[model samples]
Target: MTIPTARTTAPFDAVLCDLDDVIRLFDATEVTRLERAAGLPVGSTAASAFGPGRGGPLVLGQLSKDAWAESTARGLADRVPAARARELAAAFARAPFRTDPEVVELLRAARARCPVWIVTNGTPWLDEDLATLDLDGLADGIVNSARLGVAKPDPGILLHAAGRAGAAPERCLFVDDRAANVEAAAALGMATVHFRTAADLRPALAPLLARPVPHPRR
Candidate 1:
């Protein structure tokens, strides 16, 4: 599908973007590797760590990082020693978080034009994760689900992100790798871009950057 462009008439005052699969890449292979190394079957780590019963509370701020790690370790204790499970959990928590230079450049350009906010459904260590990628200063603001006690596909976090950008929901442009999140923002009257790659993102954001910023009323 073609990338959707922002409306030129109203124009967006800010950009709200997702973290994983957009700014930072999450390696599924690494998770599988960790699972195997821990003597569990493939996908076991992901299922136990991110699956409904375990990771839901972590993402929603109900569980602390240590608690989530301990929970994940417990889930693996049958296959691996409890100590090894904890080690695996630590490795998973410290998984490679790399930033795309192209996306970073694009975000920097976008930030220069208007406010840019990182709106992500992440764990309790969201800030630490961003710091690892040197992405802490890239955006004007960050709204993490783990910290907010809400997540996307729920309009509250989107509205909260826009508020953090100091822009009204309708005046913000939201970009996410997930279709559900894009649709959720669009439902709230915000312009949405379903981001697939950096190439697609540039064109989607070009019009917003090219448009003249509206002056404040005297």
Candidate 2:
């Protein structure tokens, strides 16, 4: 299907982008507060919740809210009783449950430059949000963690996305706000850009996007 996309001058072959902090309003501060309320040990945060001490990795399969809840439980085991795990998970789940128009526009611009592929870590319900955002034309394809049974930083998940984009790991450029995920992609031979803000992304992405090269290759 022809996915709808806005035109832009970004340069690239294939775009494998992330959703959370990159497109939506994901508040680390809020996650920290929830972690504290749940009674996790000091310095225990959402991402770190699934760190080594807990389970191997918090895998969230598409459509399984239970996976999200379990990951939350593992992260805050000391503070969160089993009964409250799902509820707490639901709260954070609401963040990326919606889309930002401005971010969507940026994605459109990027999409126009080349095939756009989304690879985000979210629950099963995220498909609804992705559809609401219109996946078909907006992305050449998608590789959400929920559907793939793996989350970021895992080579399998990254490789899974690389296959969907039809681009070798080295040819696809990955953009994620997390340093670790970006580093992980780099390890797989894909170029990566750590997203600090939309503006911060331009310089790093300019050369990789499909938009008219601002200057001829030297």
Candidate 3:
């Protein structure tokens, strides 16, 4: 679908966007199935994997995705047998993900006027995941925390992203599904969109798609 245009000048110089939940969504069916087969609760595996002490290293570039999966299996050892726990962890790690087309389109529209950068707290394999969803082309630049050894809410990464987009913090519009991330961007002088749905993106990006009319010659 074609994005609508406006005459007023865009407010921001660049767009800083998140990946998970903002544009990419995961299907946890495999994780659920594995949990059920192991006689564990549906959220049990997720709790073990994402709970404190587990996901941090993986997202911070300290651990590989395989190592994280193994760590998740270890986290489940007390509740299930070793082999079953490994299976469950593998399922959760490989959960299928898809992009939000509406959000993608909005970002695409915004990109026409200014750079759109993906600034996400993600694992090292994030590029592969983006390629799988065919979303690698959408962003002009990507700031993956794992690659940079930093994550959201850290002033360094956000500043780094704004710099990558060639925009100052105050002239950037940062969008993320997490409130803490949005709050961090705001603290850094960026305009933020606490993204919950595609609807949240449209209005926040509207000003960035607007073009100011040229002044008549004096």
Candidate 4:
């Protein structure tokens, strides 16, 4: 709930990035994949157990991998086994990076000016996804929620990621698609950009990143 002081003109020393919906692509692609693999459309089962009409909250760190499995089984009336649901969820562990070349290029360009580390609410699967995108060269280090057992909006994970990235929390610039995550990072004294699109971030990052940018819609 605390707002960060952005009165400082100096640039932050590091960038802590979020993974899902911020750095990588996420969709219901896995639901179909699990359906084909399991010989049934298992989406509804997972949907019902998460208190109905909920997707993002149930999927992204809100429901643990185990909770997802168990809840899914109960929802499907034994049509989908907990073990199989877990397998399906695990299979969905990675989503490919968006093919937005500008985003990728901008990340590279930004990192040259300052160190960039991925600070995400995720399992070890983030490494696998980055590997899938062949971006080992792009990243310096990663902070995963599964390893830390805490998700963002919690300053602990942010501080931990920043510390490991050789940057202070106050000196890190963070990018995330979620407003809550952005606010959380900002509370820790990191500059935040709510990335709606690559173009939308330019204005927020213009002063911090040395680049020509068209004014973005906040």
| Top-scoring candidate (lDDT) | 3
TM-score of each: 0.80, 0.66, 0.88, 0.66
Candidate 3 Cα outliers beyond 4 Å, as residue runs: 1-8, 212-218
Write model 3 residue lDDT over 111-199, tens digit each, in one string. 76778899988998887777777764588978999999999889899999999998899999999999998998999899999999999
Please provide, for model 1 over 25-92, each residue's C-alpha lDDT reduced to its tens digit, 9 standing for 90 to 100: 86666667767776677867657788776777887988877788788888888888888888777777
lDDT digits (tens) for residues 76-189 of candidate 4? 546667777655555443223464566666666666666778777665344555665745445577777766767777788888888887878888888888899889888888
CA lDDT, candidate 2, residue 112: 61
Question: After TM-score superposition, what is the CA distance of residue 96 in candidate 2 from its true location, in Å?
Answer: 6.7
Candidate 1 minimal-lDDT segment of 10 residues: 209-218
Q: What TM-score would candidate 3 get against the native?
A: 0.88
Candidate 2 lDDT, 1-218, residue by residue in tens? 99989854333467788887777665455555666776754345455344663233334643344565566555555556765555555555554434555556666766666667888876567667666654445566667676677888888988888888777788788989989899999998887889878886666655655345343212
Q: Cα-based RMSD of the predictions, in order?
A: 6.4, 8.0, 6.9, 8.3
Model 3 scores a C-alpha lDDT of 0.87
Please give the RMSD of candidate 2 to the true structure.
Answer: 8.0
Error (Å) of candidate 3 at residue 23 is: 1.0
Prediction 2 TM-score vs. true: 0.66
